[model samples]
Target: MSLAIKPGKADLHWLLGAMLLAMALHFSHFPLWTSALIVLFMAWRLLLQWRQWAMPRLWLLLPITLLGVAGIYLQYRTLFGRDASVALLALMLSLKLMESSTRRDYVILIFAGYFLTVTAFLFDQSLWVGGYLLLPVFGLTACLVGISYPHGVLSNRLRSRLSLTLLLQAAPLMLMLFLLFPRIPGPLWGVPQDAYRAMSGLNDHMQPGDISELSLSGAVAFRVQFQGEIPAQRQLYWRGPVLWQFDGRGWHMAGNDHAVEKLEGLGEAVSYTMTLEPHNRRWLLMLDVPHILPAGTFLTSERQVLAPMPVRTRMRYNGSSHTQYHLAAGLGSRELARALQLPPGGNPRSRALAMAWQRELQTPERIINAALTMFRSQGFFYTLTPPQLGDDAIDDFLFSSKRGFCEHYASSFAYLMRAAGIPARIVTGYQGGETNPVGQYLIVRQSDAHAWVEVWLASRGWVRLDPTAAVAPSRVDSGINTALTDNTLLPILARQDHAWLRKLYLNWDAVNNGWNQWVLGYNQQRQLELLSRITGTTANWQQLMLWLTGSLLLMALLLCALLFRRKRMPIDPAQALYLRYLAKLSRRGIQAGAGEGPLSIQQRAGKLLPQHEAEIARITRLYLALRYGPHAEPHAEPHAERKTMAELRSLIERLDC
Candidate 1:
């Protein structure tokens, strides 16, 4: 068998590590059965190595491959989508370990590991994930190098060093390609409908207890880095879905028939850049009324910024918003009716209280204040775990329970406003964020998920109101940690006062934001900017390509010079004199025969040149001793090597004279 098929034990170890890491990346995505099969195949391959057992025959392997394919089909009901295809690829690669017959098979496994590393990007593009992916790539390439090594027993450290050197040499070309490549706006082919999963965040619909469920998650929703002065704590409402129509039990987006007006751009615009985490939803959570819409997204008539498709990866966008804005200068009759519409029979007591307030106050603004006052004075408390509500959820929350998160407060407040014949609705979005000093940016977590009410008045147009704010003012200024009675539910970053943890969190976020900006956010626009800066001109795609080609050429020449460069050998005075003495003997008609020993050569030289016999014999002994004596190894006493070399030099000099 060729060296290709006769795998080295070291190469097998390297391949095992690479395969295990690649499989680990897909841990959460794979089913238990699929993971088990891949692991079992790996273990069987290890056993073959350990016990010197022969690999299974092709007949047995072929049926096992078929079974694996059938199993995937049964598990996912298809073999073509992202999830199914990745799982199948992993299984085949792991099985290849057992079928290893030659060096070519090992090469295939190494490359397959690289391909698997790329698949990880389809799920998560965060900095940590990108860094983690480098390990498997490095390991697989090292294995590829180790298998081809002509020497025996290569150390993992040597293999790793060589692989790192290869990657470093290739990095410039890779960087050039990345910088010059044209980025298309969307995928060219169709994607699987279930390729990505929806995450926890505000949706178009919300029930009484919906927002509280999000509070349990500490995962990041988005990050904001302000260009100028950061917006005030109260003004940092990252608005998302606007729900106008309220069913008796829940709130949802407005119907198509309602011609409701959206908030208009008004005062000074605050410019900021936002890096949003993927929620597999179209809505881009912007501050209350976007002043300038991002390039790819469009503003809905109801004032929500939406992308053309679901964001299945990290998205960075530039936005400007005016905190002071006129929301709906005038409301259409149909929109007013929908906002005020409510189920007639349920929550009678809550509706009656709203009616009494409307009768006494005679203005929508005053009625809003009255409801807020009641929320503050009526023993209302904020809690993540609220009591379950029955048929009359609003009445139970307002009169009996009075303990709930923002959703309950916002939901009941909007219901009361409608009951009093006011145009009211609920706005679901993130409320506050923790500031990171290292990055000087704001991090909004899922725990910051909040719901508030907006009511339309005759004079002020539509006004923003938060009944939750009335009960827990700390929620708006200091964030959810202070607002909650049980701060244990808060995320570590939010509650930890330790200096080390705080520093670590901020530093990590800073690095992550930098990666997101330079890597994942690298698009055609950024490419153009980079090219223009490098060429010192207004560079186009053509110029970018030209520069990229030139850079690659330069890198190629440097690599060639390093690879073929010759090393200079140090001069040895003793060896030079010995060569001269041999030349003298050749001139005097005496020479050493092919395969003749050094002692034989010396004896012949002594017979031919009688005048230099003593010097020749002494020189011969010194030469033999220096080259093949007790001090032959360099580690023998340094002083003895110096002494032998000196004596050989003196004997050769006297003979020449």
Candidate 2:
């Protein structure tokens, strides 16, 4: 028996390769165990392909699939949500790979690969992510083309060139669709409550240590684009949830029982656009008091803008915030009472000290000054590491250990103010941001997380207070990283001093900023802004759809025309002379038939024209030698056949006409 075999039906191999690549890329985003299962399945498929193992029986596959589904349900605690659905899709792809033995099975794998690509986008569309994903996407596309054209050897160079060309050709249309497509208010199908609940940002309540943990991360929380002048770093206080009630150790938002009746009156409003990253948090970050929000946002009684749904994707909202706003036109007694509530028993020494100070200083400003003076003059240190305290955490921090982060100072300050009969709340959100010189836009990261206090004045509206600033003045003026220089949690990349590397990173960030603003962050407001700038009109859904469809059709037609254009054949001198001789023979009543070979036609023509028989035979012999003989290279005998055909044509022309 012969060990060597001809290349028979390589479509199966191409399909298997595509499926493997798809499975790898798809499961990369899933959990470790899920990815492990996919890897094992791929190995099994490889073993089967190499003839070392066989595919699982139908009975075995059914039970395994059921167990896989059960494992997913156990892990996620449900059969729904984005993560679970993605896992199920990955499992199905793996199972399909195991059973993929035919050409049609391979086609199904290719389509699955495309669907997986879209699913990855649903997770994240960052420029680097989108760019990195192109490898698998192109690989799968090439595998598809290879499977479809299985007769020829798979050409890596040709496939790469063709795949890149196709992607480039499709990019403009994809961008057009992404831009012109109308966005609808979400939950078109109601989203699961736990779709994306793990991301950290401002929660419903501001706790003492909440912002501290947030301050350690380097992830971008949101980005702001100023309409006019950007606000100063010290003045850039992005107000989020305001916590009124304090429980000695932590802070909590006012309960619904003490809900405010109405929004405050707006004064001078600062108009700007904020593109918020997805935090799985509904609260939209803006300047102090936002008077106007983009179409889909709503204003709460606390003067905070909120999205109707949790932001699982990057969102852009245009907001006009009032630097001076009168909150709660008529202050409700219940609301005031909730703001004044504190834990009944904890921090007794701190409470007694606060009461003694309040008796000495009657005014709120005098009390605030005393608190600030205490924080500044007590040899207090601003440090990330603070010693653990007992039940009286506030008393221990204020009197014993004078080292703590912003949350510690903010919490103690709020406790003292409430003890002094001044209604104060802990305001939590990012404070100062690093201004990117390249883009001239504020880049607020998780490290910018900050907390301060807002005390209600008798005549003046809420006034901002920063007890942390009293201890570390640099934190208020500069970014948090500079203030926390001694902290180990700061990003190592920021500490590097390579000028070229820094510049490259910043330039790359500028590109990402542009991509986020124009692509990922493009929402209803951005769409309207773009369409208005282009067409000078508010484009409706129908009009936008028509424009998008028409543009896609035009692009498709252009691509088809370019791909199917006729290829012109290169003309050689020998072929030109041979055609000339044939023309001479045609005038003499002798013409070649379509199916006749050159030798037979030459013999027949020689017989018809006896005087030119020798010349005809010479030309025919040279043409046949070049056409049928071994080692007859076209460029080797340049113009030799042309000279012979020219002489034969002259002889035939003279003999005939």
Candidate 3:
């Protein structure tokens, strides 16, 4: 009952556990030193409790706290933003545990644990993280219950059961708010700017090893669900940034001119919905020759789709693409100049070969075919681990090493095209995808990263060509796993050897896809659509607010009814008879004292009324035996206790008051 009372041992243990669980969620994101300090502080607090030591004095605590703050600032360069703030919160909570002795401190720690648990979502909102957070939430709720008791002596089983019951009771209210609350346009919370860094995907620059290095990662780039039949692996060329500016060693994206694209679909367009994971880039990797762009996106002069803002979160958009299309057969003079621009001088051998091909073939089509034939017949090896090249990288790959990944082949082929007077550029994007039969969708991973060449001809415009396909046809037909003879570098999910593991992964990914589409992807539009379907007409924000308010009030009333419902205490037959006997004595002005035992009351009654002494003594003896004697023991026969109670009741009924 006293709020200022020191917390009991059980309460302290619960507080420590709740803090541990909350901090565990962030350990992976925290710096190593920060995580180490958190663990050290928690261990010190536990030792203090174990040894029954006093709290650390202010002089001892103040300096350590300052040092911790300085360490955090040094690690993050500032004591602000999402990373630093979360680290400071976690460290301070552990420090708070050192002095958490009172019920007030216990309550503060429990609430702080709740806040810390919610912060984990700011970094990751995946289904696994969301499900794991319930653990800390339950621990904090149980700790709250522990602090409410004066003695804090509740058994762990009982406490856990109570916590589960509370969560279950709150589930309806949570669901109601989630469904009916007015939906917002952006994320539920405002994340810091630093939250978008370190995301994995293709970048603007593509060196010889850029795509090869990215091919080693198994992280999902995007998932596509087709409105019609899924496209073949070779046709699944998801186009990203087009690199027109090639340095001697690397290729970079050109300046965004925002030129209107001229495209004509030659075949039936394949409609599909794309759920792209954030790579902190503006480019939306749509399939090749996308005629219908998603809303809020536009096609560049080179047919690269661009969003207005960098995607900092998982997003879903709808677009249709034609496998066969004519894209920008005609280019402006400026575009033409930029496309043909390359490093002034390098790869002399490569340039000489291209010139010879130009003189011999004299046309773009024949020259391109000659290059492909040479790659196919010249013992060119397609490998993930290509030897490092020197300054003349293109000449080295073509003349000496002849071993490279897709980027190497594409870069060399594009250079040869430019040297031969054909406008050519490198297109970097994903090449192939694996279909998840469970979800009936295509999952394109970073392992499918690829580079190909696009050459412009006089009449046909820019034509898509993949020199890697010429060297290793399986690279496009199957996947990178099948294309590489040595596939040990690939992630287990990307390889085909572990059939059972891949199946399990597919099942899990399918569940995650559903969670992404129906849970995380639920936005303002989804809310409006769902409401319109539920009602006969379209529901606006005002109607949503009204429904939300009404649902909340109704939920409150239901909770109140459940909480305040009356409960009847079971009556004991022996106690009932004893109380009746006492009432009879009270009527005769011979009431027993508050603390009087049955024997004492019987003796007093006998002294006051000698005629009823024998009956009174017998009744008292039978009642005592039935309620508290050997017959009352838990192991005693229930029938015996009932028989004794019946005898006592009969004797009391026979006695006169």
The lDDT leader among the candidates is 3
Question: What shift in Å separates residue 50 of candidate 3 from its native position after superposition?
Answer: 2.4
TM-scores for all candidates: the values are 0.88, 0.86, 0.90
Q: Which of 1 and 3 is ahead in lDDT? A: 3
**Which model scores highest in TM-score?**
3
Question: lDDT for every model?
Answer: 0.83, 0.74, 0.88
Tell me each candidate's RMSD, in Å, in order. Answer: 4.0, 4.7, 4.1
Residue 572 miss distance in model 3 (angstroms): 5.1
What's the lDDT for candidate 2?
A: 0.74
Backbone clashes in each candidate structure, one number apiece?
Answer: 5, 0, 0
lDDT of 3 at 568: 75
Question: How well is each residue in 92-127 modelled by candidate 1, as lDDT tens digits?
Answer: 898888888578888878888898888887766678
What is candidate 3's lDDT per residue for 273-325, written digit by digit as tens?
Answer: 99999888989989997878998788787878888888877889999988897
The pairs that clash in candidate 1 are: 4-102, 4-103, 5-101, 5-102, 5-103
Candidate 2 pairs with clashing backbones: none
The candidate 1 region of ten consecutive residues with least summed lDDT is 186-195
